[model samples]
Target: MSFRLTELAEADLECIAAYTAKQWGEAQALTYTGQLTHAFRKLGGTPSMPGSRKRDDLAEGCRILAVEKHLIVYRHHAGLTEILRILHQRMDLLLQRLF
Candidate 1:
């Protein structure tokens, strides 16, 4: 399966990189972003694998994967994985109105 990030997810990643870089450093930001990228690829290849939680409550076929302090919200369908959002663990997901 192939994966793509929604505009919101892309924006979230950009914000994450900027925040991480400001609080830590450029190297740490790169490292964290790399980890997120790796996770996206892994999930795209094996979206239903263990360690990812089913989130049908949010949407049909929805799934959530936690990496570090971030939560990746996605769905796999028609041989494609669509990343819906990348939110901080502390964020209130319901308030975000995640699709």
Candidate 2:
């Protein structure tokens, strides 16, 4: 399966990049974002991969995986994995409109 990000997820990534660059450095930002990109590819290739969990409380078929301090929220449908959001682990997911 392939993968795509929603508008919110894209924005989330942009924010993450900007914040990491400002707080750490361009290199660190790139490294962190690259890891996220790698995770995305792995998830696209294997949505059922271990470490990702079904979040039924959030929405049907919703799954989440943690990378560093962020969570990758995604779902599989229509033969593709749709990334709904990239949020900080500290964020209250229940308050977010994830699905």
Candidate 3:
């Protein structure tokens, strides 16, 4: 499977990387970004695996995961593809819609 990150998601990821660089360090920021990227890839690699996540909705074709206090929301589209959203775990996710 492959993945396509929405523009908003890409921008948010850049913001996250910048924040991590300031709060932690460039090295740590890269690590965090890498980890998140890898996680998203894994999520796309096996559609069945994502459904195991708590609160997942296979019917909705989406799943959520917690990564370093942030919530990663992702949806699998047809053709073994996925889209990702990195958000504050405490936020009202619906308000973050970009599509």
lDDT of each: 0.92, 0.94, 0.72
Q: What's every prediction's RMSD, in angstroms?
A: 1.0, 0.9, 2.9
Best by TM-score: 2
Candidate order by decreasing TM-score: 2, 1, 3
Candidate 2 C-alpha lDDT tens digits along 14-89: 9999999999999999999999989989999999799999998889999999999999999988889999999999
TM-score per candidate: 0.95, 0.96, 0.80
Q: Give the TM-score of candidate 2.
A: 0.96
Answer with 1 or 3, whichever has the higher lDDT. Answer: 1
lDDT order, best first, reads 2, 1, 3
Per-residue lDDT over 1-99 for candidate 1, one digit per residue giving the tens place of the 0 to 100 score: 589999999999999999999999999999999999999999999998789999887777889999999999999988998999999999987678664
Pick the winner on TM-score between candidates 1 and 3.
Answer: 1
lDDT comparing candidate 1 with the true structure: 0.92
What tens digits encode model 3's per-residue C-alpha lDDT throughout 1-99? 577777777877999999999999999999999988887777677644633353343235566777776777777767554555788778876666634
